[model samples]
Target chain A: MKFHWFHLMSYPDLPDDFREKNRSVWVDVDPNLYDPEVGHHAYNEYLDELEYAGQMGFDGICVNEHHQNAYGLMPSPNLMAATLARRTTEPKIVVMGNSVALYNPPTRIAEEFAMLDCLSGGRLVAGFPVGTPMDTIFSYGEPPATLREKYREGVELILRAWQEPEPFAFNGKYTQLRYVNPWPRPLQKPHPPVWIPGGGASVETWRWCGEHNFLYAYLSYFGYEAAVKSMDAYWETMAEMNIDQNPYRAGFLQFVGVADTDAEAEKLYAEPALYFYNRCLHWYPGFTSAAGYMSVESMRKGIKSQVAQAGSALSSIGQVTSTETSWKEIVDKSYVICGSPDTVVERLEDLATRLNVGHLMLLLQFGNMGKELTMQNTHRFATEVMPKLRDKFGDHVDHWWPSSGLANEKTAQPAPINSELGGNSQPTPD
Target chain B: MEELNLPSGRSAKVFTFGDNTAVGDNIKGDNARQDNDNYNDSDNCNDNNLPLVFFHSAGGVDENDPFLNQLAASFKIYAPVAPGFSDLEELDDLVSVSDVALHYDDILEALNIAEFHLAGHSFGGMFAAEYAAHYPKKVKTLSLIAPVGLWNDDYPVLDIFATPPLELGQYLFGDPDSELAQAFSSLASDISGNEEEIVESIIQTVQGLVTAGKYMMPIPDRGLNRRLYRVIAPTLLIWGERDQIVSANYAKDFAKLLRDSKELIVKGGGHMITLEFTDKLVEAITKHAK
Candidate 1:
């Protein structure tokens, strides 16, 4: 399995009563709670943690975009990817990524992704996600009724801009372009690998991803057991489409916290885990499944919710919003796999095998987690947890991975972790 | 259930209530020869044959609506459910008010109705105004009850979808505890024993809002301010004085744009002025249309 160290960079200082007292952590979230001084210290520390993951030999370092949300600080993830490209080496600069629909022209995404690929020497995985309702409908003011269409058109334009050799004139219902020419074509031939990170509830998304051969990365907050229903839906869709059961065609994100022993890991992560489950996921009730957010086709299949709760991550099976879930409930459900290396390895292997998850995006840095703890967690997972699961999916070829090291003999074999790239600086908390 | 095959290659179900037509008959199917006309005659409407194409609000329309039942006694009531309101289909075709106006035209033409009195309430009020703006000459008279095609930064249209379902009655009814409002609230309780029916009702209610949201969510204005001058039909704009959904102040906005229009503000009424003051509303519509 391929390991990508993902950071949500949740703002650290929401009050304990944030869930009860505040309107939301997302759109219309009270801005006064955010302290730029704290953010300055936090951002640098966060970037340093990612670079540490890079030097620790993670297959990828990931960042994503969210707007006007205290849940995630990065409004523009490309800026973060650019910084990672210059600061780190070896790891694929995976941006899980720009919300394609929000851009006016959407060619901006093509230009920026291309720039990242060239700058990172072709080690970039371009992720196209239709952003959450909070980000797209509420914050960006895109009409919920037409947001999906806008997203589809935006992705098409970006793809054509990258793949089409000549500058072409394009006219669409949402977007009309006179000359679609992006300068400085990407270093990766035919463009970088396109991974569609989705909620996996929308049938249209499943069919679209399956037909396009794009990796449908299911980012569920509710862990693997809760994920069974959604991930199974994707695999079922693939079967219906008569495609191969290659695990490489899909990716899954899970929040993971690791330490020396199971009890110790629980104790260490409990506070941050509570903060994340309670604060960062505190979506206002009505906007979670905003009106018309799910397409008619998905609703017809009796999918009562929108895109597998990636954005609307309301607990359907559990029914309790994450805010009400205790640390014990959190772990029992594997919301975050808090345990020693052996415990994490066993559960992860079971999950990855059951769900056929070849690409694992582990959220190591979460809400209110101090940089010291995040670095320690990243260190433990990389040194202990990842190696055990590496060969589990070795039989399946990852066609969705970036074609970087294939062309260059120098980059073919990645170098081991070294202090030069900012590894081993922090003393292991254990 | 007067199913119409629209010229746009779309088929629709319309509830026709009046003098000549039977309620819920297959108007254009194999039974067409057996029944030359099958509009619903639920109220035993007087044989005036003066049709009133009644448009409903985001709350949805029913064949048995007391207000429509009253109006049917005076004119043939053709109540067509908006495309996606309950059926949850053709939603994309009803994205904008202009699209909605054209869709209504096709529905009317398919039913072979012309130069009829047009009236609507709330979201339907907005739709009626839009259709009137499109084909001014086709409408003999128009009545809009709490229409929502105009927006004021000061008195904004209340977002029904944004408000929690439990607290919605305060914005919609003049008195939440009134007999009619109580009956409407307890309508859900009428099916409390059947969980499956309750779930279906919730789904349909939400579906109605989602469909209505296409034209009304975020903001209800759809360029009707620039185009209301095209409506030449004599018009009546009504509002509850205490309406929280669309304030009575909007009546002035609509009146200013309409060359031949008047306004009515019912005392102590909210957005659902039609349901709250049905007798007053029916009398006003009949007098104005006459």
Candidate 2:
């Protein structure tokens, strides 16, 4: 199994006074945490960690963009991708991407992304996110209700700019251009693959992704059990869309902290995990707002409700009670993977087996976690967890672009639709 | 400056002196004012010896806009037909900004100016920025006058000056009636007598906005900052100090990020500084060319 490690690279220098009072920077962390000097250092260190992940045999390294927030400092992930382009060889550089609607003339996105793709010699996976209400409204000044429509327009324009070999004209309700052409075309044929990273059912989004043959990654911040439900919903939608249920095509993101032993890893990860749950999620409540973005189906549905709908618009904020989650609770629910090499492997294996997830995204740099601890976790993961997982999964995939050698086929998991369980079972039986 | 009604059914008004070099004339004459009928638009410039192409302000009356005329004299300017504004055949077939780019490219090729400097004022400036980014190689320089593309949350708001300045300003900025107000305003500012004749001129030229306005494209999201690196040519970003539509800070920031670029803020002017400070603008253009 090819593992992907994504570091949010959060710069954690909350003001001394703010932290002393134990004020929640959790969901809406202190924006002041991003000091330019400290940010510069932390960003470089994060780049090192990503490059290290690549060097350590991870298949891909992921970086994303966020604006005017302290939870994540990368306002332009392409800047980081460009740096990585020069810093490392191999490993696909995934820019979870610029929010489409947030971009004025989406062609600019097309051009810059093309430049990075060419610069990287074709190792680019372009991600287009509809964006959260906070980014679309507060950050970009976009009308909330129009976010999805604007996103659609932006995507249509950008794709045309990239794919159309000949010059073209694009006129939309919001953007009008006489010429839609881009230079420094991507190295990949017909442009790099497009992936949409979203949260919740987003049934329409998943079906569209499946129809378009793009990868769908559910941004799982709520942990493994929740992730299983999201992935399950995606698979069901894929089947409904009459698309093939390819396990490798499905991916999940998790916050992972590993060390020499389970006890050590757990103790070290406790504060960071709590910090993420309390600060990152609590501080950014704007991610969940009554923006007209929610589809009719989503408007009526409750959290964990069975009605499949397009991207979840409202967060069931009051669902989870209490401000803090203990390490014991995290361990019991397997919401996170914090343990020794053996323990990490066991937890991941369980998740992969349960969800039949083809791609695993490990978020190692998160919360107020410092650079030192991040590197330590990376080293341990590279040396320990990766090897054992590879051994169990047998790394024999048809395409291994960046790294070398072939994965052994013996460790491959059975197809989700196979008759191994029962020939007469429901096609997408959970 | 020379004005000639060509024998080939085309009229030419050429300006040359300080920083301007341009030749242009209105197409519909003084009868098509407020004429809702769309006309076919086309332009041809063959300034083989010229190194610059500049587009003048709203009226298409190149001679009267002294600031733009002065800039034209300092540089090789080609303020050609802006579709319906000039005598060229107009088409209602236009739909997108990219389409305008394609058509504009034809104009450039027809001009025999393979690669040249480019500058525009007010609405025209917005076109220059987009054109430069699209055809970076064909452009050697870019000059804008109170350009309207960047509208950040903190964008400066321009104060209107006419008797009904606010209403006039709204029209000038984007109202369909902007053409009528622009013509009357331009002629009234230049000469006082014969309001009837001036009104006629306004009507004939006012309709030009339909095509002229086509050149302005919606500014992209963080587009200016990201595309700065893509433009390889030296750039000159200009804005009027008294101009209210776009802030000087925008120009300052744009200048800072635009590699090999310079900002010139003209004093004693508003968004219409392209008309108010023609002399100084021409001087700045001439200096930058050197």
Candidate 3:
């Protein structure tokens, strides 16, 4: 299995009465609570943690985008990726990634991702995500009704821009381009590996990902057991579409903490883990699920699933939204797997085997977890735990990983499209 | 109430009154037929009365609403449930406010009504204004209750979509303990065995809001300010005095923009002035319609 270190870069200094006083930690969180002094230290320290993970021999370093949220400070993951590209020699600089729909022309994403690929020597895994409601609908003011269409259109434009050789005139429903020519084509042939990160709320996203042969990375705060149904649904979709069940086509995020012993790990992680769940995720439900964020069909499916979950005994997903969950409850539910190397390895093995996930994105540094503790946790996991699980998925060839060492080879130019005729020069399929 | 089955594969629930006018009988597969039309042969139910068409707010056209029932007694009332506002399949053709306005125009053409009085509440108020602006000759009088098309950065409209279901009463009613508020609260409750009903109701409500968001989300302004002057119909603006959603101050703004208009502020009311002060709304709409 491929392991990657991910950080949310959350602002940990919420006031003592934050839950009582603040309406949310996102969208309209009190700006006064954010101190730039703390930010200066936080950014450097977070970057240091990522670089440390690279030095400790992880497969990749991941960063994501979120806007106007105290839970995540990286509004521009590209900038973070650019910094990582220059700072570290990590095998993969995974930007999982820019919210494609928010950009006006969206060709800007093509240019930026290309730049990152060139800068990182083609080790970039470009992720296009239909961002959370908080990021897209509320923060960016994109109408939820048209968000998916805009996102798909943006992705198409970016892909075509990356591959099409000649400067072409393009007109789309949401975008118009007279000349679509982006300089500095990516170092990777045919472009970098594209992955889509989603919250598993929309079945259409799963189907689209399966049809396109793109990795559908399910990113959720709800742990493995809670996410089984969604993952199974995705694999089922892949099977239906006749896509290979390559484990690399799936990615999952989990909160993890490691220490000398199970008791010590629990004691060390309880405070930060509780703070992460209680304070960082104190988002208003209304803002979280904005109207029209999901399509009508998805909404119906969601209601059905919610009703089913309500009936089940393992209804721990519902508790993630509640403010009253204690540390023990959070740990027991496996929202955060905190234990010694042996205990963590056993639990992770079980989780990985059951879920059949190849890409494991570990959120090592969470809310209020200082750089010292975060590095210590990173070191323990990298040294004692990751080695035991590396050979588990050795039989499968990961088609999703970046062709890193081959970046220096020259890429072939794409065949030109006849723009005047308004059709591809290539033969049409029957 | 009559159900009009349009060729567009969408049906409209319209409460109508007048002579026994059954225009389209060939239309098949409808719950309400020509004989099912709830036409009361009252004294004021004449073509001369000039059919007053009522468009419901974002919540939906509650036919049993006492306010609408009261209005039906005096004038020939025809309130069409806005497409996608109920459990019915949303009309894919009606995408924007302009599309909905044209759809209503088509309804008028189907009914063979040359001119009529138009009134709407909240989101519907915005629609009424847009319709009047688009086809000024079709409407003789326009009434808006807490309309939402115009936006002001200083006094923003409250986000009804983001408000928790239980706290919605606080935003909609001036007195939380009022009968209407209590009724709304009761509807919000999740009672056992009523899960289907509750889920359906929630879906309908969300569907309506989603339809509204096509025009109102991220800001309700759709250049209605520039077009308000085009509405030659005599306009009447009704507002809740204590409205926490759209501030009462916007009434003057609407009055200023409308060429021929006046304002009525219902005392002891909130965003839902139609439900909270039905008598006052009835009085205002009746005075204006006449």
Candidate 4:
């Protein structure tokens, strides 16, 4: 029943004085008035918001890693997480985390994650991802075929670094480690719980989560209906493997918004979501191409798109990124959830009950949405939808996540919110 | 990255294709690999053969038979299955011609066949044109047969009735009732040959298409002019004199756009001329490959 909110803090008009024109060499930016000073200011403002959310009764706060992209400014979410860890208390600090394969020596991830855990008193949810081809190949120079293997080895090394009591030697095809010892063991014994964010129904990912009993979050950008379908696909595999159907073990993510009325929320939220996907997701050429023939079944059933049969044509040049399929289109397909508190609550409860899932990850900051609107949506949901769900669940499953018995046991309580009516309910920075 | 679920419920992330043979590589399967692998390399040759990767057009049929193969006798060939149409793992994330083109870059890198000659048919030609445009250095020479990306507004309109099942059989093979003609007409002209071979191949391919119907769809009109002019590779433009799908008039249009290129006209032959008239087609390919 514990609710974790993940924010990407997509900014449209960052304060002019704080923008950095040459902050990142890898990605293109607006040349005029792009000041490094402005970038840091905006970064502080974003962190302040996440901290506020933690205080506003959210169980956990999440940040992610992306490089050379304005869709999200955090090329290194670990930096942001470390900052939050120092500032916040109680709430689990989940770094939706690093793209393990993107780093040359993924030990960098282990070190940064360990630092954040020590700084935050051991609240961390470590997430490992095989970055999108655009990020992995174009930005990081990691080849696609080697991506799965790289992620695999990086996970092995980081986990061992946390749990292995003695120094050890490790060797692998892509990564080799001789010292094999990491400092600042996590606050959670053995390690913090592992959360794997899957773009879609990655069968190997589901199996891995099911086998290890790690929390599997289907990190989605499409919408809710697709999320359910994807989760169902994962559940089917989980069932085949006879993995427990406990709610906390499985999680789904959505771009959520709540307002006085469904229409108001939809109108306010639609444009930003569209902008994030259509413009910010663009990749420089030579990223997605594959040499071998991927089976048709994989495309339709697993890869999940109508463009699958176009073969490599879908990834070819002269192809403009398609316009965002509308909110109505998404609702019909269950891609998003934007409505009044009652409507949102009903939808969420139904979705969770239908899928029989335990954990739900809510992405409140999307695309270039402003902080004002994002805060409004978060406050309303926290005040309305969350309390009901929190009270509804019985003792059958642990309502509070990051419980002490968990391997990565971090504090489950969120930062305390302002209780004096609606007057000044802002969260204090950690 | 999640680990794989083992049958025993313990997680393991290891899965491999492990040299598994494709089911359709038989007579019915089109065996696209064999089409690229079957070269007329009868003359004295070294192991260091020039690789010819054939890009199938929209129909997903291999066009490197007879003609492309006869030319392949002088070099190596590697024809790839159109993504999602072969025995390999399917890609669900791709859509639009640009995405396909980018993904092809991944394929080439994965195979470690750095530099090679690329030739595509129809829509495949559009993909090849995109590849040449993006990775001109990787391309040794480009050959496009009835390429579809270049548009000629004045081209003749498609008459669906003229090539319905019965009429298409009569138009291609002089036998409306012949299953071989029907099979060949359903595929491209070049692939239609002996009764047994054509029918079997068509049956399996059509089934694959039907099964993949959920994922297959027409390409949208994405902006191409911004890129078509940037291809700098030496190119060969092969088109049917009477091409209807992309129009014969576009031949000069494409030729004009390509800075370093040549054109070959398959007189009276259709878009699938590489298979229909193999000898003359082989001559054109040899002239360029040399």
Question: Chain A alone, TM-score for each of the models?
Answer: 0.91, 0.83, 0.91, 0.82
Q: Across all candidates, what is each one's fraction of true contacts kept?
A: 0.25, 0.00, 0.39, 0.00
Off by over 4 Å in 4: A14-38, A266-274, A281-297, A303-321, A325-335, A396-430, B1-68, B72-290
For model 3, the chain A TM-score is: 0.91
By summed lDDT, which 10 consecutive residues of candidate 3 chain B come out lowest?
B26-35
User: TM-score for the second chain in candidate 1?
Assistant: 0.87
Order the candidates by DockQ, highest first — what do you get? 3, 1, 4, 2
Ranked candidates, highest TM-score first: 3, 1, 4, 2
TM-score, candidate 1, first chain? 0.91
User: Over the stretch B155-261, how does candidate 2's per-residue lDDT look in tens digits?
Assistant: 64332111121134433432223454466445334434454443334334333432443333223222445555556667777776655556666786667656678
Q: What is the DockQ of each candidate?
A: 0.21, 0.01, 0.34, 0.03
TM-score of each: 0.88, 0.53, 0.89, 0.58
| Candidate 4 docking classification | incorrect
- Residue A142 in model 3: lDDT: 80
Error of 3 at B48 (Å): 3.6
* lDDT, residue A341, model 3: 89
Cα lDDT, model 2, residue A248: 62
Instruction: Write one digit per residue (lDDT tens) for candidate 3, span A198-224.
Output: 987678998898877788888988688
Give the C-alpha miss distance for residue A29 in model 3, angstroms.
1.1
lDDT over C-alpha atoms for residue B122 of model 4: 67
**lDDT by residue for model 3 (B221-274), tens:** 888999999999989999988999899889998988999999888888898888
> Which runs of model 2 end up more than 4 angstroms from their true locations?
A15-34, A284-287, A303-322, A391-430, B1-290
- Model 4 chain A weakest 10-residue run by lDDT: A311-320
Regarding TM-score, does 1 or 4 come out ahead? 1
